[model samples]
Target: METIKISVIIPSYKPQNYLWECLESIQVQTMPQEEFEVILILNGCREPYSKAIESFISKHPAGNLTMLQTDIPGVSNARNMGIDNARGEFLTFIDDDDYISPTYLQELYNIAKDGITPVSNVIAFNHVTGQYETNYLTECYKHLYNKDKITIMQARSFMSVPVAKILSTNAIGIRRFDPEFKVGEDGLFMFQISNRIKILKAASPSCVYYRRNRDGSAINSLRPRGQRLKNNFKLMTNYTKYYLQDIRHYNIFFYISRLVAEMISMTFAVRGKIQQ
Candidate 1:
């Protein structure tokens, strides 16, 4: 068997046919199917989801796909399973609901094989409006635009998403998501990876990250008043601890600012609940 050049991990729950469409995008990639593998992680689903994924795989044998089912919940655990099972030289993640262009895998693979990480243009597509957009985050990090090599400092300071980057398997070897964090887990994982490797941004937009305009479908979905407070506290504590060590600046003021910001956000959140 030919060595797998790339491994794309998609962790999904009951995403309906959205997962199937996401798989279709990969099926049409410009790269050779044998060179890359797709690992679909079905997290905490019963008969219908299992049946659906089995049906998807049987229809698309050219996908070179491997589907794994885990009874354990959470995207974190699902992703961890992907990391453990992957057999490719380079790795990247795509949300089950999102789809990429035909050139997505090939373009990023070309950059990554030469020992440079490749970050792509993330087009946030409104599933409802059928609108695609590259927002201000890319503009704000203009230094990374059209570049093939990026320093840790440049990567650290800029806001980035895992979907935007294809990383070396060696670079991400054994790095697992913190099961403790339901939110901000992906962010922290990216932050940790960028700190350890050189990342490059792909020249053009190649992925359509579908965002539906719906409540309860996002990471920040509103929770019950008491549960919300606990989750918020966990989020704050993790961020504070991470930033305290992450603040590379010598100035004490910047460190203090992060703490203050977290506190202020928490205060207003609780205040809003009280007022309600």
Candidate 2:
């Protein structure tokens, strides 16, 4: 058997409408089939969707795909399952609703092999409007190369989101997702690993992240203001400790201020929704 260099981890819920396209994109990746494996973690999906995913996997070339079923109810749990089950030297988290360009995996693989610890590329589309949004660290990242030494602040800022990045699961070690944090688990996971991992940013916009806008979709619905505030407070607390431990005091206050502002805005957002 050929060795697998990359493991694509996809956490899926009842995303029947989008899973086929997402799987198809992976099957057609420009990276040769022998180079990578796709692991689909199906959390709380009904039998019908499971059967569909199975059927798709059966038709694919051997040794390229595997599907695991988990009773876990949240995305965080599903992602953690992926992390635990991943067998590739490099692991990637791709959302079930998103589809990548054919060159996405190959591009990420090329940069990752350059000895960068955690490498991430640009997410080109929001999947709602088919447009890209500027990330918080895009400008700062422009100054850093694939092999440059990165401060904890730079790593934290760059790794704010787990998606759009390909990481060496073996280098920094696989950090499981926090199942308790449904809102900012990805951010928290990235924050925890940023300190121990070197950073690399890919210059391509090949990853297409699709944000579903339908009502009740995880990305669409808003939680209570109190809940949002609580989550933000926890994230800030965690981020502060992570930064302070790494001696990046400059970014600590920035995180606090951003948390406060987001909390305030969330309050008004909740009120507006209630009024509507």
Candidate 3:
């Protein structure tokens, strides 16, 4: 059997036509097919969606790709299953609507190390405008342009999201996304796995993750201010628990201050929401 260098996990729920573009991008990676595996999990919805996905797979043949289905709805649950079945030494995540540049996987694989996480630049592709723009996270990652690596404390801001990054399987171990959190699960999952990551490295500028910025997408969806605050509180509790354990090398003072700021901001946000 060929060695799988990386595994790309895509958790798709009630997907749209954009899924085909995402899959096609992966199908044409710069890396050879045998070097990586793509695990696409169709979660929550079934029947027509499953049949549609099956048809897509049949039409576009990829020997390295594997499609799995589950009645579970949460993206975190689907990702957990992907992690459980991942056969690669390194792992990266891609949303069903997002796609990566041709050299994305190869670049990530080249820079990935047991104690390091390689991050890619995220480009927001406007669906309607047909234009690409620099995303907020990509702007935050500018600090990495000249440096070789930085600690989790330095990369904390942008590290909140799991996209545009590749981590080693050994680094991830058994840490999984918290299914309880629908809002801040990505940040919490990154926090859980941060214990093993000593440094963050930036991949080649060419290694880009094209994030589709469109209406009704999961990232753009909003919840009530009260619900968001509740989710924020739950995330704070989880973050505090992991930080207190001191297994990871992060600045406690910095983390505490961030939480304090978030509390104030959330309070004001709720007030504004109520006023409106």
Q: Each prediction's Cα lDDT score?
A: 0.68, 0.67, 0.82
Candidate number achieving the greatest lDDT relative to the actual structure: 3
> What does candidate 1's lDDT look like per residue over 46-130, in tens digits?
6788887888889887858988998888898988898888888888788887787788888878777677776665555565666
TM-score of 2: 0.78
TM-score for each predicted model, relative to the true structure: 0.81, 0.78, 0.91
**Best candidate, TM-score-wise?**
3
The list of candidate 2 runs beyond 4 A from truth reads 1-3, 117-158, 171-174, 205-216, 241-276
RMSD of 3: 2.5
Off by over 4 Å in 1: 1-3, 133-143, 156-160, 206-214, 224-268, 271-276
Q: lDDT score, residue 106, model 3?
A: 89
> Per-residue lDDT for 106-225 in model 3, tens only?
888877744567888777878888797767777866777657777776777666778898888887898899999887788778877776777788776788898888877776676788
lDDT of 3 at 13: 94
Instruction: Write down the RMSD of all candidates, one decimal each.
Output: 4.1, 4.3, 2.5
Span of 10 residues, lowest total lDDT, candidate 2: 206-215
Query: Model 2, 1-276: lDDT tens per residue?
Result: 334788899888887577788888888888888788888888986688889888887787567788889877898888778777777888888888877677778877886787765444444345456566564445444554453555545555556667766877764375577787877777667766655564455435443333333445575566776777677677667766766776642345445544664466566656655210
From the highest TM-score down, the ranking of the candidates is 3, 1, 2
Candidate 3: clashing residue pairs, number = 0
